[model samples]
Target chain A: MRFKWSNVVLFFGYLFLYFPLICIVIYSFNESRFVSTWTGFSFKWYKALISDPIILRATVTSLKVAGVSATASVILGTMAAIIIARWGAFPGNTLFLGAITAPLVMPEVVMGLSLLMLFVGMESFFGWPSRSGNITVIIAHITLTLSYVTLLVQARLQDLDNSIEEAALDLGASPLKVFFVITLPMIAPAIVLGWLLAFVLSLDDVVIASFVAGPGSTTLPMIVFSSLRFGISPEINALATILMTILSIAVIMSAVFIYKDGNIKNM
Target chain B: MYRIEEIIISWFSELMKKIKGRHFLVAIPYGWVFVFFICPCLILIRISLAENLIASPPYTSLIEWISGYMLQIRINLGNYMVLFTDEMYIRGFATSILIAGTSTICCLLMGFPMAYAIARSSEKIRGILLMLVVLPFWTSFLIRVYAWIMLLSPCGFINNLLIRLNLIEAPLQLMNNSCAACIGIIYAYLPFMIFPLYSAIEKIDYTLMEAAYDLGSSPLKAFFSIVVPLAIPGIYAGSALVFVPAIGEFVIPELLGGAQTLTIGRLVWNEFFGNMSWPTAASLSIILLIFVVFPIVFAQRRREAKLSIVD
Candidate 1:
């Protein structure tokens, strides 16, 4: 009886979760301009996407920002993980930790506004950053994203055998050599997962980008927001479907890797 | 082992011998936070105190504390006074709080059952079920909103189907209102609610629940007395995650709420970029910041407490 009830609950649960997504995917091949009535299937939307210059430009810009932001975030995050998790943590460490984690919980509007205010202040107080632009956006992304890298790397760091570094040190290798040769390689997989997460988040982020991006800076979600004024577009369905595919795969894989230990006994 | 340790230690000591600026290791994250996050937040507090002017950005003097409280720009308490004095900002803030709170409660309501189901399912089935929940959110969010439009529209799917079934003669006007916005908000944030709850449910000891049953308690009592309290950590985490974002939410409300609805998030967006009232937007944002920063910062501290435990 208990099992039967759980099955029923699970059925409804899955239905609620997937209904809209499945609708969108089905409608991606949708022929009607009206997102509702299904006339017939066509690849026209996919084809139209190739020819749309604005979306194409936005896609490229998004890719560039994600790439740059992810790389920068990963490096800093790795350093943070190493310092805080692997090696010597400074005094009052958790406060520094709190500041790092603050961005994840900080409302998007607050983050964007605060960043804009900061840039404005910098321009006035020091005459540095004389004007606000992509530099500000990149900096904002870095501040937010680095924490993800740090958190992921820190989790990985805690599971690592510290004695490995000791062994390398005992073998006549210096701390720098031990880090590069031993610690870096061991945490490489986690670093990759962290980088991928940072990249995808950077791409999907609309709220922050809308506020701080430079002139003519059209990220994918930003364009999506502006075009939303026009109601639903078939091409958007195609774009969203693709992004969904990529992000899902990244999320699943990361969870699989990160959650490996929890399933160890079961496996 | 002793000889090997001696050799390894000496070689590592040689490598560290030349490296300087060990402090740089700590400097990067510290420097970035100070210049970017901490200082900027402090600066915003300062700017919020300033008076507004048209010609200049945030036009007003920096500090007019206890003595010069009347001057609008000279750190007068006017912005804050206006925040209290005007009902619009107050109402807007209230609306944001109410909507976000409702949405978070709704998430908990819908998500707990689903998460429990996922937790109790067979391993293979659980994987597939979990995938289904996450897969939709992975899709285009806007398109999903559009999907709701189709379902809720007068001539759309749900209406059409209902009419065809003779369930109702007239189609209900569903879209372009607060109700639609609520549906959309819940729809969008559902996955967030589910994931945290699911993970938490997975961690629960089934034996404990069974023990409650064996104690002759009713299933209802078992759920309320045993299952719910144990899941509080996940519930808190999920609500914080959902509520914080939902409070600042603009895209969903703007897209679905149509013309009738007004939200603090949309209000802020409109004030800055929409109305081009940059100073007002800045001041409003400062107000929004006060409300958001307090709960959100407090929540993170609580989260870190659990997080260290999880690790």
Candidate 2:
């Protein structure tokens, strides 16, 4: 009975987790415009999604912003992580830690408004980032994802053995060379993880993107968000299906990679 | 692969050398975070003190230089006063807290057992189970929330399924209610709750549980005494993780919540975007921030104090 209870709990939990996702995928092929009610399956929504220019544009824009911001965030986050994990006490170290991690717990709405205010304030003062658009959106995303990336890398860094780097340093390698040859390779997994996390976060963000996006730079999430308020659409179902498939592929690939890495380490 | 690795290493080394000093690398991110993260929050504080206006930037400046270096500053407390006096803001604040609190409890209930099961699972299955929990979180949050709308709408999956089963004579109105809103929040945040609890429960020495069992303690009693107390930190962390974001949740409540449901995030959104009342929005945000941030800052201080003692 105890074993049965454990199985029941896990079954219900996984059911709750994946049922809605399966519904979305199934309904994307749904012939009916309405999400519910199973008609004969058809590929009409996916076809419609292919030709929808706004969604296509938003998808492209989301990809661009996510890519740029994720790259930037990884670089910045890695630096912050390195400092926190490796560097000893420095001036304003506590302050730096506080600033880097504040966004993690800070509410999205608060962060959005603050960044929006900053953009507006800066634009008025310096005339750079004159309009809230791609650059502004990227900056906001980098700020939001930086904390997450930093946390991931910092955790990895804390677990890292320092003897490897110390040995390289003793061999007369410059600090720069040592970091690149030794430490960077050691933390590459964390960096990659951080980048992927930052990418997903930026791609998924709606509130902050809504706050900072200009007329022409609307992201896919923003589009999905607005469409949701009005009513359901099959096109969105199709889009969701595509996104889920992509994410599943990514997840599976990474799982395979991790498994292989484990096997290699075991050998 | 070896050639590609060489290229990457050379690029990285050259990039590192381009920065004159090792400290400069640290300075880059440090400066970026200070300017972007810290400065914007500081700007929020300043902007919250300003008067709302109809002009381009939409708020009166808080600072002015008086004759010959005497700085004249005007701070508007009226914005905050409005938030207090206005029934809408007050109701919104209360409603948000109520909804978030309820949703956090819901997530905790659902996530705790699942986490426990995963922690108790075989090592191989545990990793796969953990991955399954985290997979949905990687997908678009907006899309996940939208999934609930499809499931909860009048013509949604659950209602249709029930109707087909003859469990109900007609489709129940499941969508656009506080119930749906809570469901959406619990679904979305369950992973956050589960992962922390899993880590916490995984750390428990199973030998203790075995000893309890040997002493003839009831399984429930053993669980309550041995597991629950040990998982307090996870509970607190999970609750904070869910509660803080759920309190200011915009998209979930906006999409899933009924017309009457007014969360602080939705209110802030409307004030900033709908009413164009920047100061009022800022003030409401400030109030919300204070409520949300106080617990977090307090907890951090406690943790720091504990850590200092340990050191």
User: Which number leads on TM-score?
Assistant: 2
Please state the interface RMSD for every predicted structure, separated by commas: 2.4, 1.1
Per-residue lDDT tens digits for candidate 1, residues A110-179, read: 6787787788767777886643345666788888798888898888888888998998899999888998
Q: Number of the top candidate by DockQ?
A: 2
Report the alpha-carbon TM-score of model 1 versus the true structure: 0.86
In model 2, what is the error at residue A111, expressed in angstroms? 1.0
> Per-prediction DockQ, in order?
0.52, 0.69
Candidate 1 C-alpha error for residue A51, in Å:
0.4
State how far residue B23 of model 1 sits from its true place (Å).
1.7
The per-residue C-alpha lDDT of model 2 at residue A102 equals: 82
lDDT over C-alpha atoms for residue B116 of model 1: 88
Candidate 2 C-alpha error for residue A30, in Å: 1.0
Off by over 4 Å in 1: A88-92, A123-133, A250-267, B1-19, B63-73, B137-146, B153-156, B163-171, B293-311
lDDT (Cα, tens digit) per residue for candidate 2, span B74-178: 999998888889898889988888888999998999989999999988887887898899999988898899899988888787887888888998888887787
Query: Model 2 clash pairs?
Result: none
